[model samples]
Structures are given as structure tokens and as C-alpha cells.
Target: MNKRIQILSFLFLGLSQIVFSQIKEEKLILDKKREPEVKKIEKKKTSVETIKNYPPEEKSANPVTYDITNVPAVSDFKTSTIQGQDISPNFNTDYQNNYVRFGMGNFGKILGDAHISTVLESKMEVGADVHYLSTTGLKKEYDWNSNQSNATIGAFLNNYGEKGKLNLEANYGLQDYNYYGIYALQPTSDTDLKQKTNRFTINGNYDFYSNEILNDVRLQTSFLSDHFSANENQGAITVNLSKHRLFAGNDFKMNTDLGVKLETLKTDFALLNQNKSSFFNAALLPEISFYKGESYLKIGANINFLNSRNESLILPQDKKSEIIWSPNVEVLFAPQDEFRFYAGVDGGLKLNSYAELLTENPFLVSDIELRPTNTKYHLYIGLKGDIDENLKYDFSAGYSKINDMQFFQANSIFDDVYTLNRSAYNFANTYSTIYDNGNLSEVKGSLQFFPLQNLDLSAELLFQKYQLDNLDEVFNKPLLQATLGAKYSMLNEKLNFGFKGIFVSDRTTNSFEISPNNISVPTAYVSTENRNKKVGGYADLNLSAEYKINKNFSIFALGNNLLNVNYQTFNGYKVIGAQITGGVKISF
Candidate 1:
């Protein structure tokens, strides 16, 4: 009788599990070493106006959240059954599947953005992002345009026996960029300085997971292909196998990762002369982590070897192979949930991949140099926490000694006369990537505050100092940068408005063209023969408003550089002033 009862219970429970999951299941995945944090009034690290991916857009990266979520899975299983919150939450009602937007503004600009995303029955996500934007110069009538279309498909494959669950992703993208000349040298007619890029990427991971607090292992592989219109192409592939094992009580863990990276770059600037480079890399990372009440510590080391074939730039001894080693250490002290202190020391080699540079600034010269930046040492410290449950802040300072730091500077535009300060650009209307060894000291801070009901505010600031080995100044780097932002909701949360103001301190750079061979600009302090690299500070203000007509529809308008201040971020790339756009968004 006892055996029969046990068998019955097992059968009943198994059937119940299948029925409940088939009804509706949404598994929140946190295995990315991050927590699934839910909150209202989340911080906006960057202005939406910066998402256009155009010349006038901002390029700064968003601040880190500093929320430590790497922890072992909870083991306690509650006996009393309580279902999750049903019907979703009220705040999530505004979500949608498809989004469409259209806008027009000065400079003969007409822009449209559309996104279509859907989830399949097999737990696969398929999405496409398409946008079109064209702008004619308001000052010189030169036209600068861009078009971006990308598609992504991702899925998690289960049903395979215990070896692991497979996660896969595939992506394809096409983008176009144009180079309009400097304000100092406007083209008599529209020029044909443009580049088109096509990209394809595939990534996969097989994670070994179970309910126990034991060791975890995963295998990851990825491939990338980039083809440019100017006959430049790059192909890269990477594979990594990583493992994380719990050492003791949920508080200590050991981790290790081993990876292989391969890359090839081909450049055909001249039909008769083609340059090709291939690199092979092997990397190993091992770390130990300790986490307990109010304290967390981590120690790690990175070892790498790079094998370059047919490379003439390397020294004779290092021509065939190069080895690099770096140490990593991090510590955190959190006496309470609202306050924490953290510091870290690390270093590594940053592979200057072709694809990464193309995206950072597309107006690059055709014949570019590829030099990986070797970060010899990096030290950072920070304090982050919440204040009164309404304001959160982070402050960090870092210093780094680097080799082969790449800087974008104005290319010489004249061939007849050559000087270190200015020379003829090998390619027209494009910037050149210059490498220099340097030491950088930087301090950055961010804050988010909710001062009153329905009102939110945030601010960020960055300060930097550069000491170069050969150069007097670091090109295109500002000493200080800051942003102030505010957002408010009204009409019972039906209408939302946001405003952001940005400031960039004066920066000194080298390389620029003179109106003629040589010219002079008189300044308060002195008279210089040229002002090509002398750029002044500027302020930018932007405003945006959105009116939600219904749950799935909304109307929005945005004004960028509302102050109408014309400023040059690069030596000759002057940003537009006072542009407005409006569009309606619909979700399905």
C-alpha cells in the first residue's frame, strides 16, 4: 500500500508540473551574473536625442550601475504555494511589440525609425531595427545622410539532456555614412565621401546549469564579419570555455576562462597594392571570489599570447610571437545596503579591432593603422549608494598607464606643403587614427534624484588629465564634461517631458586646414597663425515631450541643440544647432 501511494504521488506531481508550465511561463534569467532588479523611475544614463547615430549625436558610454548581483541561487524552497503577481503590473501596461516613429526638421531632414519584435511559442525572440535619416547642410547645402537596418534572432534551446542548455543568437546589419567637409573648407559642390558597412555576427553559448549550488560551466563561441564599401574587410572568430565553482558556503567561488581569438584584416586602398594582416591570440583568466556579510573580494590574473604573421612593425625578437601578462584585484565593503565602497586594479590588452573603430567614428581614412592598446596598469576607486531611498549616486576616480592609445585627429588636407601641425590628408574629408602612449587620470560621477512626486532628475560629470610620452596634448579629449537632466510627468501620468543640457570644456588638438596656406587669428592672449585645432567650449540643450494617447499609442516631439549654439566637436566637424522633430509611435 505504501509503495502504491508513493507512485501515485510522483505521477500526480509530474503531471501538475507540465500543466502549470504549459498554461503560461516566463522564466526570468539572471545567469548573466546580474540580478533581475525591478524598480520604478529608473535612471536615464543618456539622453534619447543621442540615439540617432549621426554626426550630432553623443558618443559617451553610459555609467555602470554598480549593483552587485553575482550570487549563488537561493536554495530555500517555500512550502506554502503562492503564485506570482497575476495580470502583470500596471506600469508595464505601456509596453508594445512594434514601434514606429517619424519626424522632420530643419536642414531638409526627414527621419523614420521602426522596430518590430516578437516572441515565438518556442521561446525565441526575433527583432528588426530599421531607420532612415537624411540631412542637407543648412549652412553650405552639402548633404550628409545615413541609413541603418539591422535584424536579430535569438533563442534558448532546451529539451537536450543534462549536458547543458544552448543559447544562440544571429545578427545582420547594414549602415551608411557620409563625410561632409569642415566648416573651414566647405566643398564648392556636394562631394562623394561616403562609406557603407555590412556586418554579420553569430554567437552561441551552452551553459551547464542545475538546481544545486555546485560548480557552473559554459562554452561560448562567436564569429563576426565586417565588409566596408571602400574594400576594407575584417573577419574574426572567438571561442571560450569558462567554469565557476562554489568553494565554500555560498560566499566563495573560483572561476576560470580560456579563450582563443583569431582575426584577419584586408585593406585594398590601391588596386595594385593590397595589405592583409592576420593575428592569432590565446587568453587565460583565472579568478577567486569571496563574498560575505558587508565585504566582497576578488583576485585574478590574465595571461595572453599574440602570434602575428607577416607583420613588419614588430621588433625582430617579437616578430613571430608576443606574450602579455596582467594582474587583477578588486575589493568591496558594504556596511549596509544603502552604502558601499569599492576599488579595483586591473590591466589588459585592448585589441583595436577594425569593426570597433568603424562604429566609434565612421569618417576614418581608408588606409588605417591597427595597433592594439596595451593597458599596463589601471587603478580605480569608487563609492556608490542610495540616499534617503530617493537619490542614488556613484563617484569614481581612476588612473591608467597605457600604450598605443588611439586618437582621432584632423588629417592633413594639403599635399604641396607638409608640416607636423598640418599636412595634406591622404584621403579627403576624413579623420586619421593616431597612436600614442600616455597616462590618463580621470574622475567621473553620476547621480539620480527624485525630489518630488512625478518629478525625476539626474546629472553626470567627467574630468580628465592626460600626460603623453611624445605629444603635448591628447587630441580631441576634453578636460571637463557635464550633463544636467530633468524629467516630469503630468496629467495623471499621461504626459511626460524631459530636458537635458550638456557642457564641454575647451579642448586643444593638433591638425587642421587654414583658409589659405597660412593665416592668423588674433586672440586675447596672443596671435596664432592658425586656429585649425583650437576649439572652444559649447553648451547644448535638448527637450522632449511625449503624450500617451492610449496604452499602445503615443505622440512625441524632440528639439536638439535648442540653444542654437554652433560648436565643433572635432577639428572641423561643427554640430548643427536648433533642430526639431515630431512623430507618433504605435505599438502592437
Candidate 2:
């Protein structure tokens, strides 16, 4: 008819130009995720990866939930606030490997704890623990009515074999004290004026990831003893070995660390004090790293080998060997996602052990001496993120130069000859350990506030400047410090409440001559013993409450130094007032 209607109008304009154009057929996706046995099982080996492996929020800066209905309160268990924010307590309480607690207080204080653990299904785990603390009312005098006791026993082992992980630890401890800060004209009081200690520890570690460059090995050993009333004794032994090297991903990264440490110190007072101090330490750290996006850099060095001795200073220049170098750098800059900036230069070699300085002063002075404290320079800068996620912050600035730098003096101040030609110094009871050549400058700040969602608030501040060499005071060092804390949680999580406050400032000691007749002893004032003595300053308050009563039991109460402010953390020492502890914890 017109050539078959022009071929049906050219097949309807070729199906209307393929239905008006814009493609529309999809279905040919064949990407078995790069098949080939999944790229051969991701190339097998992985363990020496210098940088990568931190999925748990980069390994916990916080944020973990095991969600037991959002368990958070236990007075904010696992505490870490004051703005550092560690707060992790989603408590299923470690599946109750076992637990126990007991308590007593009011000067004759006593507390005890117990534990047990197990986990074997080839993930081998085992544990043990025991702890106790004691106190008997005191107020007669070396420094003011004192009695103390401490104990501990611990054991652990964890293994996750199949060519890797293994860890073990052991511990033992005991302590007892009573010196009574004399000088109402000596004489001696009770329990023959005591002080006793004993400790033991062992540690082991192994981490083999055989492929991809992994390695980690460690071992440690320790022993300690301290006995004194007069006929003093101080002892120590430590051994350490370490090795680490692992590198994996993040563009370029490398790591190597090697270590060895052996220490020994033994001293006996009287007979012109016997001596023995030996140290042989070695360390080498190598590092290089770079990370893209959000930036990060790490470059390192910290090589050292020291051999020091004193079998009583038979002089060979007093026997000491040295070779040290420090500079371990770090950097980080986070473009966004809340913020981050960090900078660092760190140096090491601390090890001033005698059970770590009697566990931070159990009223030292049993002819104690041990050395190996050298920071040799440190500089730091920091700023941490989080403005959302309920607020978080950290700020820091630091500078340090220490060579020995350890101080705690106030002993041998006055006795025979008022302590000698205007030298029998007199500050307070006792505590001795000095090694100064210090320099430190610091500034710190922190804050955290969680509007709600159970509430939490934290605060911290510190400012300091201390310098000493031929000493010009750096004694108890506290140039300003602060803390504020709070925690809350209710019903659902089963109750928890807490509060804390602390502040300190102005500290300088030559044993505080501070006289206005000692300002009625409310932290001391006055000043002058040729300079630097103004202990003063104090404020402290604390409280806590807990309930939990179900899922494994809990009940707690603690109230310490509740503004019964009578400070003196050394220097005629006298603190501990207004205290209460109530406890009950059971999970089996």
C-alpha cells in the first residue's frame, strides 16, 4: 500500500529510539570478590605489620559496650575520668571467674579481696588473686599514730597457641609499717618501731605471628626485701629481657626494639652503711612510620647501655659506664572528625626500684638507695579530640630534663648535735631519697562532660615549674594541681553515684620550718630554713555509692577525707581523716 506503509513507519521509529534513551538494563555483576580462592586467602601470613590493627576504636581510647542493658554505673567502674575518660564498664563482670570482697573501717580498718579464674577451651586462661590491707588507729607520734599492713598474691597465665600468644605472671607481696615520726625526744614506741616488706614477681610473654614480620618477647623477674627498726636492710633484684619487631601496612613502617636490664641493690645500715648497687641496662629502639590521610609520623631512637656500680664506691670514678642517646619522636595531625594534634620526644630509663620506691612511699627511709633515673630530655605537646560524642578534651604541654631526679627528703634532720652544725635539719618524721638535677615545666588541662545519658563530668588541671640541682627546692613538688569528678547513673543500670574533688598548691620543703608556731598545724605555713618551706595548701573530698544487687551482687560505699582537710602528704605527715568503706562484692 505505500510500500507497506513505509515499513510500518520504520518499525515505529526503531522502538521509539529505544524507549527515549537513558540506559536501563543492568545485571551482569560477576565479582566473586576477586575469586581465585579469594586471592589465595588474602595472602596468608600477617603478624609483623608495623602499623595496623586497632579496630576497637584504635584499641580503646574508650567506647566499648557489652550492653548488659547498658551497664555503666559501678561508680563508673574502671575509673579513668578527671577527663582522661577510660570509663569502661558494661560489666558482665568477666563471666564471673570468681570474686569476693570483705571490709572494715574506722581507723582499725581492714579490707580483703579474693579471686579465681579459668577459661580453657584451648584459649587457655587461669588466674588467682588475694589482697588485703590493714590499719590500726594511731595518734601517738613518730609522725602521728600509725599502723599499716598490706598483702597480695597473684598468678596468671594466658595462652592462645597455634603458633602464637602466651603470657604468664606471678606475684607475692607483703608489707607492714610503723615508724611514728619521733622527736618528742626519742625513746621508741610499741611493736619495736617496725617496718617490714617482702615482694616477688615474675612475668613472661611471647607473641609470635611468624609471618608478615611479627615478634614480641618479654620476660621479667623481681625480688625485694626491706626490714628495719635499725639494723636496716634493703634489697632488690630485677631482670628483664625484651624484644619486639613488627611491621604491617600503612604505607611504610618499621619497628625494632631490644632490651635487657639487670639490677641489684642491697644495703645495710650502720657499720658505716654497707652497700651494693649494680645496674646493667641496655636498650635500643628503632622506628620509622608514616601514615596517609589525617597524618601521622613516628621516627625513633633511644639507644642506651649503662653499667653503674657502687659496691661502696671503690672509685674508678665510682665505676660507671655510659652510652646514651635519646630522641623518639612522634607526630599526629588529624584533619578533622573532631580534632587531634600531638607531638613528642621521649626518652627513658627510669627503674628506681625497691618495689618501685616502696610502692610510692610507705614512709621510706630504711637506708634506701637505688638508682637509674634519667629522662635526659622530653618535650611534648598534645590536644585530643571529641566535641560531640558527649564532649571530651585533653590539652598538654611539657618539657623535661632530668638526670637522676627523684626526691623525697626529710630524715636525719636533727638528733645528735641538733643534727650537726646547723645541719641536723628538722622538717618532719622521715622519708629520704634524693637525686636532683631536675628541670620540668608543664601545663595541663582536661575536661569532659556528658550532658546526660547517665551523666558524668570530669576536670583536671595542673601547672608546674620545678628546677633543682644544687637544690633550690623541688621537694614534694606540687605547683598547683586540681581535679574534679562526678558520675551518675540510675535505676536501669542499677544505681551508682560519685564525686571527688582535690586541689593542691604551693609546696616547697626543707622540712617546713613554717612557724607561726606551725599555724596550729593546718597544713603548716610560716617559712624559712634558709629558704623554701611552705607546705600549706589543701582541699579534698570524696564520695561514692553503688548498688547493683542482682546479676552477681554488688553494694559499695566509700567516703574518704571528706573535707576533714588536715593535709600534709609528707612533712610531719598527717592525713587520713573521715573515712568510711562499706563493701560487698560477690560473683561466682
Candidate 3:
């Protein structure tokens, strides 16, 4: 019986162990099935919190209450008196955009100028200008009529928008000049000695405000003609592109300029048989600049393609097509606001157009040639700074090597006629260009002093030295030049006075004599025994005063050549003497 009881106990213990194991497995399975729902609740809690609902209304065992009562307050401060201050009314000043001035003086002088500009529909700016100046003639005893007249009319339209700006302009000009200097040496008909020039121009420009590459574009065309059957026509187009980029751990600006120009000149010459010259040039300019707080460095080059059919009195007719390159580099450092330093080396090809030549010296011969000036290199260093709040100064020095520099030489018809009276032309009153390779050095300085709020004084000086490869002198080029000016206003700015003085140093020129037999050939002239001639320089002083009668009217007086020095600028040309003029100005 004991053995039977032991077996039964073992069986009972084994069965209990199996039952507990099954119960534990069932609990684990249930938890696993609910895991995803629990995780979802936890995720919702983390993503968005839910406020608990307030506990259901319940009666409180104890409650509290407070009583309200009114109380009076007393004031112990006294009121103080306030003082009033006087205020002045503000007035707006009306500005003038249109003005007309007319003046007359001795030597039968007449001057008239008019300008008007206004906004159209508050969107576009339109303006027009007209100017006329004339001088009847100099003293009759001077033996020649130095009459000159100039007139010009121009109109411009400007349109500005959020994206860009556009500008268009057209101009017409007329000029009449008398070759009075020629008459001083010989007698000639008024018709033969007079020159008239007509000029017309059209220009268009557009600027893109926010474009990354295309910044500005311009197109220009002009036509110029003279009474002697000399004509020049020019057309040009230019485009400027720039981009700002970051590279090599620094900010840099890349700029590119593309330009194309075409020019033609036609002049009738017996020897050359209606000489026609044409020039075509295209240029590519690229540069990179690095800028840092008031300092910068720029490195670039100008690449040019030049083609020309050129002929001149001295140079035989030749056709040329070539490519040229020039350096463009600059550095600037502004260590301080009051002091700055800069240095640069630059060069380029310059067009010597017929219009430019005629503007410089109106007595040029019809057989003149055209060429581009080659400036191989020009190195310069400069210093500019404000000495003080009221005074400023600048100084600079430069050196350059140039090729094909032009100079003017006077023409003579007869070699044997020591005295000009015997020859038909007496002194061929015409000039022609001569070119040479040369080196030039220059120094310049300027100063400005503002001693008073309404008064200004300024002065400038320049000095130059040239060494030519083949020419004896740099004809008609002044070695030294200076200018001084003073301006003052008083009596509530109603009265204004100004003074200006200009001084130029002496220059050197060459005289040439032609073989009478080959009068038609322009290249037949030879230098005189005295190759170099000295030309005396002169000083010109001018004074002006104006008294404003009211806001829209004013009376003014001008005095020119106050020293009355009869100075000759060219070989035979004498500038006008002293003169005075008084006029009234109207503003609206």
C-alpha cells in the first residue's frame, strides 16, 4: 500500500508542472497579439497630447467668500504751469527744369541756349535742347573776318522700369568757320576761305538692372560732312556682360565687353582721285576682379581684330588685317578713408577718325589719312585723399610707350619764296598729320579748398614730356598746363561771382615747303631749314557775375580774355581778344 501511495504523488507533481507551463505559454501569446494596439496608443500619445477631462462637478465641504467696500483717496500734488514753444512753417522749394539764356557782346557775338525736360504721364522722361552761338567778325583792321557760328539741336527720351532702363537720343549740328588766318598772309575769296560742317547723330542704350550677364547695350551711328566734299560715317555697337561668382574661397567678378565699329571717310583729292578710306574693328575685352573691403585687383586683356584700307599724303595706300592684344591690370588699396593708393597698367588701340581730326584742327587738308594709335603699355601710380574736411588733393605720375602717334605740320606751297607774298597760296594754310613712335612721361596734381559753404576754390596742374623716335618735336602739344578757379555766392545766394584762369606753356612746330611744279601732290612738301619754330603761349582769364532779380529771372555779365593778350594757338591763328557780354536768364 505504501508503494502505491508514492507513485500517485509523483504523478500528481508531474501533472501540476505541465499545467503551469501551459498557463505561462497562453499568457505570452495573448500579450503578443495585443502588442500592435499598445504600440499604436503610445505613438498617438507621443505625436499629440490629449488634455484630461475635468473631474465631474462635485460639492465641496467648505466654501470661502469675501466682502466688497468703497474707499476715498486724497490728492496732495499741485498743478504746474506749462510753457509753449514757437514753431515755424516748412516751405517747399520749387525746382526748375527748363531754362533759356540769351547774350550779346562785342565782336558781334550772339549766344542762345534753351532746354526743356519733363516727365510724360509720370512714366517717361523726354527732353530737348537747342543751342546757337555766333560771332560776326573781328576788327576790320585785322585784315580778315574771323566769323564763326555754331548751332545744335538734340532730343532725348528715357524710359525706366522695374526690370531695365532705355535711352534714345538724336542730335543735329551745324558749324561755320572762316579761315581768317589764311587771309592774314594772302588774299582769298570769302567762299574759298570758309568751311561749313554738318553733323547728325543717333544713339540708343539699354541697361538691364538685374540680369546676371547682360548689363548694358549701346548702338550709335553718326554722319559728318564738310563743305569741301569731305565726309565721314561711323557706326558702332557695344555690349557689356558681367557675372559674380565664388571661387577658390573668394568672391570674384568676371566682366566681358564686346564691341564692333565701322568707319568710312571720303575726300576728293586730285592725286589720290577721291580718296576713300574704310576701317573696321572688333574687340573682345575680358576681365576678372577680386574686391575686399575698399581694395581691389583687376586683371584682363583686350583682344582686337583690325582691318583697314588706309591712305595718306605721307603713307602709301595699304591694306592691313591683324590681331592685337593689350594688357589691362590695376590694383587699389584704401588702407584708410583719408589716404588711398592705386596703380595700373593699361593699353589699347585707338581709332583716329576723320571727325576727331577735324574737331581738333579745322584747317586740316582734305588728303589726310586715318590710322589707329597703338599704346603698347601705360604704367601709372597715383595718390588721392582728403587732407581735411574742407580740402582735398590728388597727385599722379605716368609713363607710356606709344606707336603711330599723330602730329600736325603746316603746309607751304613754294620753296624759293622766303617771303610768303609772292606765292599763290602764300602760306598753304592747311595742316596734315604725321605719325611716329614715341615715349611719354606725365605728372599731374590737383587741389580743392572749400573755405566757405557758398564759396569754392580749385586748382590743377599738368606736366608732360615726350621723346619721339623720328620727329624733332611733338608739334602743338603743350608741355605744361594749369587752371585755377574761384566761385562765391553772397546775399542769400542771390548774387554769384566766378573767376577762371587757364595757362598753357609754349609749344614747337615744323614748317614745310612744297615744290611748285608738283602742287597737286600732297607728299611733295619738305621741311624748312629751320625745322622747329617756337610758338608763344598765352594766359586766358574770365570773370562772370549774376544777380537774381527773382526766382525765375536773373541778370548776368561775362568778361572773357580780361588780360587782352592776343595769343596765337596755331602757327598763324590768333584767338579773339578781350570781350564782355551782359544777358538775362529765364528759368521755369
Candidate 4:
């Protein structure tokens, strides 16, 4: 046919130029998506005139800062409010063998407390305590190893005002003691059988109060320092005033106080460089008290004056003056709420002078010893009662009289050497020394019973008497003591058991002679004898137990001389028969 219609008219003219090149590649991908939406609508109309001619750097989102040097500096930082007032240290140690009865002792304890506070106010506190003790053997010629040490430090100040109040206190202390000696003369010699003692102390206090005076009054001041190695270094100063009142009988009330005290003492022993002494004391005391309903009354008096000086040239370097009188009275009687009654009386007077300085550049004097100035009296009575709710009773009695009483008589060519002016007069025993007079008396009683309610029962009694003017040749008899005890608590109270017993009696007198020629010659040509002995009454029993397995744990068991009887209560000292110990404790 016409060449197949001219090849279908060039295949419809190449499909009309391929449909116009597929509509120009779909309008060039719709003009690249409308040319980025027509350049984002011409960049939103040219950013609306540069955001309407610029004005908006106000973009804080909250910020005000100083670089702080690029912030990052913490070299070991620690804080818990500065470690909660920092001060934590404590250690303790204790060991025992054959425990109580003051034997076989070993202990060490340490403690500390510190405080400081402030954010806007003030406060400071400091504290310390340390102690050590030891005893292991020997106790007659000494040698039982004894040691003691003590230390204390304190400081306090507080002020956080509103009205008015102030307090400041300071304290310091040190104590040391050592003793060891056990005869045989030199059993591993500790040269001259060592003995040492030391002590030092300081104290201060100040107090003041004011309600603008009259409606409130209080004032105080105090200072004290004491040091003793053997005998003295003391000082004191005190002053106080107080007043409180409500008088027109609203059950009557009155309280008053007045005081003054000044004291000084310095005895320089400093290793026996030879005796030295000094003293100055001044005192005034006034007190009054009265309270109603349950009754109370008190009165006090003390007047003192003393100026003394002694610097032995072997005794007399006199500068002595003295006047001392003390008086006191107190009474309290409770009419109900479990009965009570008390009574008291005290009296005193003392005057002194003694001069005897031994050896130093041909200096010797002994006869200025007029020390028979005296007055001392004491009488006291007491009673306490409770009868119904679990029984209790107490009774006491005392009587004392000492008038020019001082005794010492020993001089038979130094009765075995050991003298430090035993009331000097040794122109080679100018008719052997003599002085005698004495008195002392006492009585005590107690009884308590719970009977049940965790049971506890107690009984105690003591009586003492000593009166000598030649107690048949020099005293040693008259002291009776008794004690009985019981206690029990079972398991619910976490177990606790106790028992105690004590009873004693003694009587002794001795005088002996039988010498061939140890010459002190003639006691009617020797052969003198007088001896009496009755020392056979002693009993002691003690048992203790405690256990609490909770609340920081606990366990304690002790038995002392529980029947292992074998006695000797001083003559050569020997007592320590039975022993048992158990211990465990934890606390926090």
C-alpha cells in the first residue's frame, strides 16, 4: 500500500516528537518543585525587610553570667558541714586477772570531744581525758608494779546574745605516780626502791547575770591553781553574790549568798632541798536559806586568817599568825512523801607553830614547839524512812572530840633509823620523846529490801572506837564491820546476779625483849615480855553476774575469794585466795 502508509506516517511523526519530549521532562520536575517554592516566596519577602529593620537580640532564655574563670576547681573538696565539728578519736584497753578487791589491776582509757559552731554566732568546746593503771605483783615491801597517769584539758565559750549571758572556763591537769619495792634488799635493784608522785592543775570560772539588777542578781568569779609533787603549790580566788526574794508570805521564800575567799600556799619541796613553807588565807562566808512546805533551813559561818612562813635553819625562822573559826548548822525534815529527817553540827578551831630545822651550817634548835592549841567537835544524827512500798531505812550516829591531841613517842636510838624530825629533840634522846592523847568514835547502819520485783536485799553496819592515853601501851583494837547483800534479776531483765558478804574482827598487842648485849641496857636487866593475839575472824564472799545480749552486747562475771578462805588481814599482808573473771562489752 503506499509503503505501509509511509511507515505509518513516520510512526505518527515519532509519536509527535515523543509527546513533546514528555512535556519537557514534566516541566523540568515542575521547575524543581516551583523553584524552591519560588525561592521560599522570595525568602518571605526578603525577610520582611530584615525583620522590619532589625530589633530583637532580646533572646535570653534566662542568662546572666560571669565565666568564673571557666569554672572547674575542686582540689579535694570535702564537706558535711565541715565534717560535723571534727573531733573523733578514742581508744581503750583493760585487762584483769584475779580482779577486784583492789588487786591485779590494769586499765587504760582515752577520750576526746571537740566542737566548734558558727554560721553567724559563736561556740567552741574542747575536751580530753586519759588514764592508765597497773598492778601485777608484790604488795608488802611494795614491788607489785604500780603506775597511774591522768590528763585533762578543757575549754568552753558560748555567746549568742539576746539579753545577756557569758561563760568562759579553762582547765588543765596532769597526775603521775609510781611505786615499786620488794625487800631482799636488792632483788634486781630499782635503786632505793622507787617512789614518785606528781600533780598539776589549773581552773577558772566567771559568771554574771542581770535582770537589770534588783529583779535579777547574780555574780561570780573563781580561779584556782594547784600543783603538788609531794606537798604544795596552791592558789585560789573567789567572790560571789546572789539574791532572790519573794516575801509577803506566799509560802515564804528567801535565798541569799555572800562569799569571799583568797588562799595561797607554796611549799617548795622540789626534791627535798630542805623544807620551805608559806601560807596566806583570807575568808568570809555568809549564807542563808529558808523554804516552806517540806521544810528546809540552813546557816553558815566561816572566818579565817592565817599568815605563815617557815624556812628552817633547822627549825625556827618564825612568822606565824593564826585565827580560824568555822561554824555550821543545817536541818531538814520532810513530813510526807516517804519520810526524811536530818540534823547537823560542826565546830572547829586550830592554831599552830612548830619549828625544827635540821642540819645546815651549824644550825640546830628544837624547843619552840608549843602546839597544844585546839578545839574540834562534831555531832551528827540522821534518819531516813520508808516502810510500805518496798522497805528502806537508814540510821547514822557520830561523835567526835579532839582537844590538843597529837601523839608520837619513839626514840630508843632511832628505833631503826627513818627520821624526818619526829618531833625533834635528839640531843641524843633527851629522855625519850612523849606525847599522847586521842579520840574517835563512829556508828552506822543501813537496811534495804525490795523483797521481790527483781529482788534486792541489803544490810550494813559499822562501829569504830579508839581512845588512847596508853591504850594498854599503844592502840590496836576496836573496829567491827559487817556487810550482807543480795540481788537477783532474771532473764527478762537480761540476767543479773549478786551476793556479797564481809565480817571482820581484830585485836593485837606486842612488846618483846631478850637481848644479850645489843645494849640499850637494863629494862630491869632485860627479859621483858607482853604479848596478846586474837586475829581469827574474817569472812568474805562475793559473786557477780551480768548478761545482756542485746543493745550493744554485754557479759560480765566475777567471783572474788568465794570461799577459798586462807586469811591474814595485815601483819605481813596476804589476802587473795579465789578469783574468776569474765568480760565482754561492745557499745556504740
Number of the top-ranking candidate, with lDDT as the measure:
3
Q: What stretches of model 4 exceed 4 Å from their correct place?
A: 1-285, 297-303, 308-314, 318-333, 336-338, 343-394, 397-477, 480-588
Q: Write the per-residue lDDT of candidate 4 for residues 416-474, one digit (tens) a residue.
A: 33222222222122111123556667787777765455555678777877675554543
Would you list the clashing residue pairs of candidate 4?
Answer: 137-144, 143-181, 314-356, 314-357, 314-358, 315-356, 315-357
* Each model's backbone clash number: 5, 20, 0, 7
Mind giving the per-residue lDDT tens digits that candidate 3 earns over 1-588?
A: 366447645844774475345434432211111110001000010111111221111111113232221111111111000000000010011225576777778877776766677778968878777777676655553454567787878888877676666888898888777655552244434324666778898989887754367767888888888776777888888887766443323433333333333333333343323466787788878887776655778888878788878565666788989998889999988776567798999998888876777777777766566668999899999987664455667788999999998888776543444343332223556677789999999998887765555555778889999999998778989999998876655566677666667798999976543443345654333434345888888677666677778988977777776666667767766766666777777878
TM-score per model over all chains = 0.71, 0.28, 0.76, 0.23
lDDT scores of the candidates, listed in order: 0.54, 0.57, 0.63, 0.42
The TM-score, computed over Cα atoms with residue i paired to residue i, of candidate 3 is 0.76
Whole-model alpha-carbon lDDT for candidate 1: 0.54
Model 3, residue pairs in steric clash = none
Best-matching candidate per TM-score: 3
What lDDT would candidate 2 get against the real structure?
Answer: 0.57
Model 3: how far is 296 from its true place, Å?
0.5
RMSD in angstroms between candidate 1 and the native structure over all alpha carbons: 16.8
Candidate 4 residue-pair clash tally: 7
The TM-score between candidate 2 and the true structure equals: 0.28
